[model samples]
Target: MQWAYLLGLVAAATAGHVSIPFSRQDYSASAALVKRQASKDITLEALNNLTGGGYYSEFSIGTPPQKVSFLLDTGSSDTWVNSVDADICNNQQLQATLGTCLTTFNQSNSSTYQLVSSDGFDIKYLDNTEISGDYFNDTVHLGSVSIKNQQLGLALQSVRPTGIMGLGLSANVATREKYKTIVDNLVDQGFIDRAAFSLYLNDLESDSGTVLFGAIDQKKFIGNLSVLPLRPRQLATRSHHSMSGYWALTC
Candidate 1:
């Protein structure tokens, strides 16, 4: 079953979890401790945009790692980042007032970035946001856990300014062919055990929340984690692509 807590942080799923400490002080790693004694746990920060916009994560990409912040999207299937050539990121006057396109990926700067397809990546969101760009694989670091050679999209042209890290299913991807989602790669790469994640937004007043990938923290909720079956898309026809990797209706 899909839960609301799925949007926080992409945490580790293992017997011994790595806890990456984050805070509102300066969005720095104040403490990063891996607890082998704990059953399963990780503490990565997901800062809320104070205006009640949503949560975003501070992560790094590239060989040496370039810092970037991404909007944590739960419904989006294709994970993508803003390219240095993107209109919003390049022409700062467009949305200059908002300053949303601040972070971008310069493929040439990353020694590990490998271009897979020049024009194979394309995705559209329910909000009418469209992003089209080249597909590439690079090293992405979430706190201390590094996902090497992870496939992601580099948006050359984007309707949205900020990049997004999609946690949706592989079948929901808009690529030429279905590819493994980030969660899937985590398990295959021996970082996590399962392709499951849970979100825990501490409270409305809190500065940040947590997202646990692969393992569920039983202490957050009441009795048990409800297993909600994926209901077939009823809001639109089978031709609709926006409904992919999402629950038809909330339980």
Candidate 2:
């Protein structure tokens, strides 16, 4: 059976020769998938994760590029980071690596950082963990390209410290209006011709994978990719509307 390739990205400027790295370490299905359709370019990049089958990508936030690691989750739509002043990143949370929110985003040093909102940013996980923080707009560097005034959550209180780089569709974004998700901003800023991407994961031994944005890596996969329409009706019915945040398709 043929599988559909997953899509997501970090917004930036320019188009050709754009690529980034995704880092993580876990044992899961590790295979590459490429997409081509209606004449649009597909970009590719690597991901990184330490354990528990999670994947992360590298992006430079703020003016001088304070490099940060974020879990590339297409299932959700709000991208957030833990602030250094947050009390949630305690010693106990640091010890337990599983579901532990690591890394504190220092917003003060960012020359381009701007506070957009002071309230109503919250997210609750299945395990009863949650986070609440203010919203801010800043520059995000994807490889050498730069995307200006992108919205991101600056967490002040969170059950976990690890931040999330949400790639969900803009229509389904959980945050307030006047801003765009990572994928949406990419299309609006001309970083990619279309708002689509592909995800690839390596085997347990290799612990490596790639996520393509506006261009695909032909060397990663063989055979033509079959495009699957997003089946919201079927998926919503199956999920009972609870898990409808993802780009669900009835393939």
Candidate 3:
């Protein structure tokens, strides 16, 4: 389910104005709080000409961690990869065009794979293509942080083998058993302080961007940081009660 809330930051202001550099904001903190503060910067590979036309990030799954490229998206919440058993995933042309089709998840190779449910996993994309499979809990590593028992879907039926890494809020997370998304685990495990991240698209032609977790890079922005609230999305008189996902700002 997707829910929209104003994306506002509560930071201490000096001289009745929020500080620029973002990191320069002065706020009283406990000694223990200062000790537990941590952050991570994840470099996203720009995929301008890819089928998705966005960014991709590397993620390792399982105990030894099998490396895979995930489509970085904020619109969905289910972090899923293609399984070897997918029926419609054997398109040779798609494999050549999109490198993702050649990749497949081998559960037998993973020692940390824990089956959550054999049923109740399904996802429908914007193209009206659906992928369904079993849900599993395994260890996932994003940068240096090792998240144990992270819930992810293993697609058994998919048109394309490309996997997506959803960076949306918990309200939009897709899972029947109710598990924590990667961002939630990051904050829960103290890898990041806040639930906010910044994505900077450096080159439009390259379709490249940089994603910073927990903190924003001051060098990315040219001027002052204009923080805007995330207003609730209301299309027509009736709100989309079931349409819960995506970072949509009311224009």
Candidate 4:
């Protein structure tokens, strides 16, 4: 399991749902062809929970299955859920950990549970509290996908939103241990093309959301494009240090 603290950035303003087109009308036929060629079908589903501010979907855990509403986060690695029996007053760290004493989910009782070491980083939140714990390998079910031996962060307490599913392509403890994001795992398993996945987050008070797995709607384009360099794997060197500053900006 991976642990992380909430960064206190003001939530991005919600502008309702805006459809992004894959191409602009002024673009030449060639450009339109290229744009269409790059598109794929991506499937997404809306999720709901009893919690007032629930996101679009429920993530499943354990053999019997404990479902928790979670946000799909690309910026972090690890998945966690709020504990039903969390002791908030006695344990401040429990506040930042998902699946604390208040939730019904119990990891300790799961037969397939195994704990991995934390990276020693004190994950802090806006509440000025930190949580510490080792990662865990377990079965994770998201939407129609079921991934066994998934790496996730299991905290002793519960914090903002019940949980998170990290979808970044970076190689971290979770990824190295064969735990992959839903999209990545799908691509690896040849269920979807590598570049076919795209996320369209519709920030609605009702917690409505959508995702496209194999293709996107053609009518959603506005005709803007920016090409960025994909990172190439290489041995650590002096040159790597120079690029670190730029990489941090993107993150």
The lDDT leader among the candidates is 1
> Which portions of model 2 miss their true places by more than 4 Å?
1-4, 7-17, 26-52, 90-102, 176-178, 202-204, 232-239, 242-245
Q: Decide which is better by lDDT, 3 or 4.
A: 3
Candidate lDDT (C-alpha), each? 0.65, 0.64, 0.60, 0.43
Task: At residue 55, give the lDDT of candidate 2.
Answer: 73
Residue ranges of candidate 1 with Cα displaced over 4 Å: 1-52, 231-244, 247-250
So what's the TM-score on candidate 3? 0.72
State which candidate has the highest TM-score.
2
lDDT score, candidate 1: 0.65
* Segments in model 3 whose C-alpha atoms lie over 4 Å from true places: 1-50, 88-100, 232-244
With candidate 2 superimposed using the best TM-score fit, by how many Å does residue 65's alpha carbon deviate from the native? 1.4
lDDT of 3: 0.60
Candidate 1, residues 1-251: lDDT per residue as tens digits?
Answer: 22354432233335623333222222211122112312133223211211114567778889889887677776667788888888778775655432456688888899999998898888865433467989999998875688888889989887556677787777777865778877777778877676667666566566576766667666565654445556565456555535645534555
Estimate the overall C-alpha local distance difference test score of candidate 2: 0.64
Find the 10 residues in a row with the least total lDDT in model 1: 43-52
TM-score of each: 0.75, 0.76, 0.72, 0.53
Clashes of 4: 42
Per-residue alpha-carbon lDDT of model 2 for 1-251, expressed as tens digits?
22226533223312543466676644322232111211233112222222225677778899888877777776678888888877666556443533454467799999999998886677764333567888999998887678889999888886444688887776555564736887667767887766777665554444456666666665555676555566555354532664445677554
Residue-by-residue lDDT tens digits, candidate 3, 1-251: 11112244323211211111111111222334223331222112211212344556777888788876676666678888888676546766544443446466777789999999886678775434467888998998776667788888888876554677877766676565567887777767777766666655554443345555666555555545556756466333243345445555665
